[model samples]
Target: MAHQFSLAYLTVQGCPPPEQIEIAARTGYDFVSLRPIYMGLPGEPNYALAENKELLRQTRKALADTGIKLLDIELARIHDGVDVKKYLPAMEVAAELGGRHVLSSIWTSDRALYTEKFAELCDLAKPLGLTVELEFVPIASVRTLAGALDVLRSVNRENAGLMIDAHHFHRAQDKPEELDAVPRTWFHFVHLCDAPAQIPTDREEMTRILREARLYCGEGGIDIAAIVSRIPAVPFSIELPNLARVKELGYEGHARRCLETAKAYLAAHPRPQAICCA
Candidate 1:
């Protein structure tokens, strides 16, 4: 079987509602991931939960028109102390919109509390038929692959898994062996983007590079080839943070470049046959 890939549009934070589907379709992406459908703004009133329903409807119609799918939804900003209720509705909407997965982050200052909360969230998500994928961020509570694996183990739910971001893998200084250690069944989603060789000292600066300057798969210094070779089969989502460049080149041009680069990288290092899940 051939590997499946998707393109995430979080690079365009303020992307006009009308253009979202257009961009995804024009880019030849298999699916699009949206953030607002799962996570809401921190400390602000939780109006987005109600406000997002219509947006979800529009997004679904847009996908229908463009022939693209909404693969996943990310709740990236909901901090540790926030109520999980604030995000569950978004998860429901994501399911309603035909998304297969919901992404989240561990944001608590207390590691133990955060772990417990994450496990609880996983339990909550199980009955909804949604997979809770924890994405490890360098500045968040679970800052490394090992940290994510620990949380997943604590959760101990079949629906819980990891969403590996290439930037975080490199930022955490994880080795290829770390990738090899991930259980094939627990690898749920993959985010692809590449950064420069020189690591940044400042967190904000580092985030900017991850969001904006990342090159396509084989165009940069990241060891994506080796990482992809070890993982079980999962949808690879390209999330380059260069919206301005994308706008300049137009969707087709930008997507073709990204896809070609990824194909070249995968060609150079073929993945082993994935272990089938029940």
Candidate 2:
């Protein structure tokens, strides 16, 4: 089967949803994974589709004009004192935009609270036809594949799934083979990117690298194919976020390069084919 690619918001972080959709279409992406729910990060552009009606309308028009689908919208974080219901409007907007998945991550280390909130998030997103994909961030509370698996098991909801990010997976030192234990149904899609093999020891450096310095797929040292092949062949969302490259190449140029390198890498290391038995 041919691979379907999604232009993740972080790949062109400065662009709004409407512009991002246009860029994705122009640069040959099958879909887009957006950030309709603003996270209030400093110096970040707030797409805030749920709050901005005009922006949302323009975003819808862009997708309609380009014939690009919305694969997912991030991020419904499970943090201390987070109101899960507050994500409802964004989830509603995501569904309205034809998004199928809601990317999420846990920030607070409180296991009991996070687990309950995660389940609640799944329940809330269920009626809207969205799956809540839990991504384990190396600098966050649930920092390992095993910890994420534990949460999934505890939550035990059909709509709750895992989102494997190539950068985070490598940073956590997770064996691609460990993915075998995860249920295939739990994988909707994945975040694809690459970074230097030399893992950072400082949390600040790790955060900086994850947010601003990820490399293009083949250009980095990550064994991307190994992790990608282990999971079901779902759409890959290119989430590389390199500030310097963006400054040099501009958003369109950087996005095009991101897709180009990813395609080349996947082409060079194609997924293993299943054997047909006689």
Candidate 3:
């Protein structure tokens, strides 16, 4: 496999959906994560592809022409005043775009309610052939690999899995050995990046560090190799959001460097056998 990496939208969140696909292809990435939903938060980019027929057509065309696959679609948050029903349109579009995963987060502290609501979303995504990845962040209720695993087992939906990021993994003090307790099928994909060995104490600070200051695959102190060795054979998303570096090299250059560095790492430390690009 010559190309087996995905360019995460957050890596270059400054770019539009269509351009993300084009840049991914130009930078030698195998897949691109699509953002077609309003994050329901201020300052986040929103693409109304669900209703924009022409825009959706263009995005689809970009993917088809570039041969860069649609790895996932995102920000289906299970938070206050957010209805799971609203994800239906994006889910429909994502399935049409050949996306297999829905990136989501859990905001409520109510474990039972979160489980039921998450399972409901999974039910909606089931027939559409899209799985729900409940991303665990240090700022959220599902904060650890163990917490995420608990939620997955509680929901127990076939189309539901855990989405782990190395930054959060270390923030929660989760060890690579902890991967043993997680079922192999419980992972749909993994978010890959590295960060400083020193962690911040403030929640907002931690959040900013994760979204704005992530280092490349091996540039930081996090053991990306050990963490990756545990994730099941699956397509990995390069989600380095180094804003300063982006300002220095631009999106295309940053993406190319990230891909090259990641490919070298993967070559040296190959994942478990049977892994294939998505």
Candidate 4:
């Protein structure tokens, strides 16, 4: 199958649902990634799995109308644990909306518990034909590549895998060799972004890093081209949170620039030649 690319919805947090869909479609993105937390504030009215049936219906209709696939549902925070009951419903929603995977992250102190919870969640997801992707965040318990791999080993399920985010990879200062250590098959999804070397001092600083400082694929100082060349081919998603600036330039203009930057990066370093042919 051809590799698919997506623009994550977190980049356009302030926009309405229809505008988000339109932006992804206009940008030449084949898929759209949704983060449930981005739907609304914690206590405010929002699309929780059980209560948001109409909103979910609208989102599905929006994708159908716009021709942009809902590639995945990102559970940005898993504070209490995996919450199998909550997650199972979300998996149903993902399947109903045509999403192939569910992206999630857990707190650092919860890692041990998550190891067990994740395995149970995987068993629940398998029957539904869904894959659970664990994203390692800089602030999360599974911050480093080593920590992520350990969790994967603990889960030990065929459908459980990692979501490699370039930003987090750099933030965690992951060693190059760690990439080779992971069985390429363990990665189910990848999120792409670039940032400068300066470290953040606070949450606001980190937010700015995500929204303002992120460079387009090849334009940044990060060795993203080299990194992408090493990893196995998967469904890569461009997550330029700073691209919200594109709204001022218009959606098509913003998307064109993102795609052009990505193309330039890929051309500079083609995929690494396989050591052995299949």
Q: After superposition, how far is residue 83 of candidate 2 from its true place, in Å?
A: 0.3
C-alpha RMSD values across all candidates: 3.3, 2.1, 2.7, 3.1
Error of 2 at 214 (Å): 0.2
Candidate 3, residues 1-61: lDDT per residue as tens digits?
Answer: 4436789988997688789999999988889987788775568766868988988999999
Clashing pairs in 1: none
lDDT of each: 0.72, 0.93, 0.84, 0.71
Q: Write the per-residue lDDT of candidate 1 for residues 239-269, one digit (tens) a residue.
A: 7776666778665567657766776778777
Runs in model 3 with CA error above 4 Å?
1-3, 272-278
Question: Top model by TM-score, which number?
Answer: 2
Off-target runs (Cα >4 Å) in candidate 2 are: 275-278
Better of 2 and 3 by TM-score: 2
TM-score of 1: 0.87
TM-score-based ranking, best first?
2, 3, 1, 4
The candidate maximizing lDDT is: 2
Error of 1 at 223 (Å): 0.7
TM-score-superior candidate, 1 or 4: 1
Residue 159 in candidate 1, Cα distance off native in Å: 0.9
User: For candidate 2, which ten residues in a row score worst on lDDT?
Assistant: 269-278
